[model samples]
Target chain A: MVYAYLSILGMALILGVMGHRHTEVNHATVLHRAWRQLAPLLIRLPIALIAASFVGELIPQALFGEWLGERSGLSGVVLASVLGGILPGGPTVTFPLILVLERAGVGIPQLIALLTGWSCFAVHRVLAYELPTLGWSFVWRRWLVSMILGPLSGALAIAWL
Target chain B: MTVFFLLLGAAAGALLAERQGLEAVTGALLSAGELIALVIPLVIIAIVMAAYAQALLPREIVERWLGRDAGWRGLFIAIGAGAVTPGGPFMAFPLVVGLRAVGASLPICITYLTAWSVLGIQRILIWELPFFGVDFVVLRLVISLPLPLIAGITAQWLGEPGRH
Candidate 1:
């Protein structure tokens, strides 16, 4: 965690210097834009985290293991992808749940599929952000092209590992 | 959205409290605090970096490279940019809108989004590496590497049938 923070901070410092040198936008404007973006996320961060914790606790580890364990095979991967797409919230919520699921004996392939599904077919993100901003045409096009990614990747993981 | 999360949290907390005790709720809060402490700094820096990158990026260059005529090169550029670009949908989607306005092709845009979603370096570094460890991350990355290109080619085929 510390390493991640330091590396990203270093990147930010470099980008800041570059932006100052090249962009017409001044430091004040860049900071203002970042602040505008960060404020709302900061507000929601704790609430989401708390919710994730409680929700994680509610999901029994054994139950998760039974359904998504290594022996569960292709059906487990498919189920995981469907659950991943519908899983609410963002990384804050999803990653922690993943940790829990991992501890519960879920297989590597299933987890990979779950993560892919969450990233690609995130129903919440699509409805709340993509549909409104990019419109249905773009959404449908992207969906048509990438819909199989989750399961396909999961199957690949299974084959490779 | 915050409100919805809040209600969900409260409801979940209440259920846990009933099953376990108030201690369960308090434990959840404490753990949440720890997670926030670890992640907040990373998120803040990532957002700042994204903002600066947005400001510094040469719009004309991006447009020229990602335009309709750029073909395979455009797809590659989109994938690279998407992998490096940080933040959530708010940042990515707006950038896509801007790029599209400047003649970035649909296929390139799709590729960019797919790369961003599946292979964002920042996300892998901060979230996946920490949570899933090295082996899992490496395996997932290797297996999923070709996804954006595949999606991009499919989009190209569907969006421009005559050209293909």
Candidate 2:
């Protein structure tokens, strides 16, 4: 969290100087776009966070430990990978919920799997963006190869880390 | 819509907590508030920074490096460009198309996409770091860094369509 804040502050400072030098930077437009993006996030994030919090409270720690914890092994990675694909929303929505799960007892390997799945094979992203822009062939090819990433990485993390 | 579902989820959560006890509801709200506080400012700065970062990398220059004859160099270049190519799929996918039009090979393009998805600098700086903190983000990046290149190499080895 400290790193996140400090980095943002540094970026902001650097961007300010870059904008000053580049006549085309257009700070006003960037700020407007950022604010516009924030509007939707503001509504959705609060709701999701609250819901996730309550769900976290409801789920027994033992249940999460049993399913997604260290001892759950490869199956946990597989489950996390699958769930990562199904979860709605982009990073904003998924990451917060991952935090909830992490607090609830999910292991690092499973978390790695979950994040990889979401990043590589997010069904919604493929449908909405990749399909329209790159066509079905590209999507399928990418999907076939990319599917191995999450589980493979998760397994490696478990074995090595 | 996603909004409707989220609203429903929040409502259900609130109701369940209320039924369990007012204390549960209070706890949920407090937790949510704390998370929101952590996320909002980071998101704003991250998004803004990403916008700036994207602007710094000229599209034409990036595309030029992905030419068909670039070979392994092209693949490596694609991975590097993809990592820094800010914004969401909306921006990145089209950029891939642009690279293809300019004569980038299939393996290179696939590598680019994989890199963008797995090690995207913008996404990591903005979303991952803020949410998961430095240790998790760094570990994930270390593990993920070579993925796109590996995918590209594998695709090339198999003679996947467009590699030629």
Candidate 3:
């Protein structure tokens, strides 16, 4: 956690300096924008963390392992992909839940599938953002082309790793 | 959504308390508190960094590069832009709309969205690297590297027959 914090802080400082040099906006503007973005996330974060904890307690580790462990194979990957696609909210919610799943014994391959599915088949993102802006035809085209990626990556991971 | 999550947490806490006693609920709360304490600082830094990066990025150049038709080169440009573009769907989807309005092809747009979704550097640096660690990030990147290109190519092929 400390490593993550310090490295990111370093990057933030560099970016901050660069922005100050290049952009017309001052540090105050940048800080204000960040705070605006952070506000909703701040609300969501604690709730997500608390929910993840309680839900993690509810999930039986043995059952989760049986369903999505290293030995669970293709079925596990597919199942994980579906779950990932259905996962609601942003990284704040998703990552914590993923951490919980990781601790509960989901295999690396399944995790890959899960993350890929979340990225490619983000149903909420599609409905709320993509569909309205890009239209139905474009969304369908993108979905058709990208749908196989998650399972394909997972299968490769299962084979190689 | 916050309300939904809060209700869910409350229900789960109730169930846990009922089944395993108040001690288990307290334990869960403590665990949640510990995780929050560990992660909140990182989240704050990440948001601020993202804001700065977003401000510094050259938006006009991105739109100009994406609006051109350079075939494979255009696809690569799309990939690069998508990976670097920050914020969420609100940011990305509107950018795609703008690019499309300026004559970007469907395949390039698809590729850009795919890259943004799977390989975004912002998400990797802020979320994945911190939560999953370096090895997992690297492994996932290696395995998923071909996805945006594949999506682009497939979209191009599908569109080829319909081109007038």
Candidate 4:
């Protein structure tokens, strides 16, 4: 957490001190963009937390442990990997979700799925980021691939690991 | 208003204990607010940051490093970056997608995220080791290595279509 901040600070310092002379607006724009960068995170983080909290409460620890738990073997592995493909967003959300899901007795396989899905498939992200630039086809193709990969990879992780 | 209604529902649910309906309303309200506040914005910031990174970084640089020619170095570098790269892959992935637009390959992106989740430098250095133990950390690292590779290799193989 600190490193994330420090790195940002460091980057800012380098940009500010050495590169400031390039153009006044460039310097200002970097900072503006930085704020623009953070604006969305600040706005949405609270909501993800609240949902995760309830999800934690609703999902019975014992049941998740059984069906998708680490000890459940191949089926669990498949379930976990596929599940990973579905969820998407920041480490902030993903990490907490994983912790909550684990608290609910989610197995390693499922945990794997959650993490994988959060980062890899990122359905919402594709729409927000990639679709505009890469086109809808790239977004759909990747999502399609992720849907397949999430479960299969989890299974492989289970088998190989 | 929804929060108020939900809170009222929670109070009602608490009173009867049998009123799962009220509890449902409360939970729904909580989830709705959260979905709007957290999930929505998080995705948006992730996308914007991704856009900025895309705009800032060169496509050729990414391709040269993580492209097929990158070989083992790219793989290990990716794994290392994934492990240490802060933020969730969701946010990180936009950057990846941005990079992809700039010409990063499937494998590199996959490996980057696979490593992000599995290796997770932030989790390992900051939380897991402190909470679990060195043994646990080592076990996790040992276990995680193959997982991302499998994900990367397979995603690259199946999803990318035009590649060998």
Tell me the whole-model lDDT of each prediction, alpha carbons only. 0.81, 0.80, 0.85, 0.55
TM-score of chain A of 3: 0.91
List where candidate 3 sits over 4 angstroms from the true fold: B160-164
Error of 4 at A71 (Å): 3.9
Put the candidates in TM-score order, highest first: 3, 2, 1, 4
Taking all chains together, each candidate's TM-score versus the true structure is: 0.86, 0.92, 0.94, 0.55
TM-score of chain B of 1: 0.78
Best first by lDDT, ranked? 3, 1, 2, 4
Candidate with top DockQ is 3
Query: What tens-digit string does per-residue lDDT give for candidate 3 at B46-128?
Result: 88988888888757778888885757889999888988898878778879888887788888998899999899987887788
User: What digit string (tens of lDDT, one per residue) describes model 2 on residues A55-76?
Assistant: 7777679989999998899999
lDDT of 4 by residue, B57-115 (tens): 44345445665556667777778667655443345555565556555666777677667
Report the lDDT tens digits of candidate 1 across residue range B1-164.
Answer: 78987898899999999998999889888987887887777777777788887777655666666765767888899998888776678768877777777677788888999999999887786578656766788899998889999888888777732111
Winner of 2 and 3 under lDDT: 3
Please write out the lDDT profile of model 1 over residues A107-151, one tens digit for every residue.
999999999989988787888888887888788888888778888
Among these predicted structures, which one has the highest lDDT? 3
Model 3, span A1-161: residue lDDT tens: 56677788898999988887884857888899889988987888889889988988988999999999988999999998888988877787788899889988999999999999898988888889887777777878888887788888899788778
Query: Residue B50 in candidate 1 has what lDDT?
Result: 80
* lDDT pick, better of 2 and 4: 2
Quality class of the docking in candidate 4, CAPRI style:
incorrect
Could you tell me the lDDT of residue B156 within candidate 3?
Answer: 81
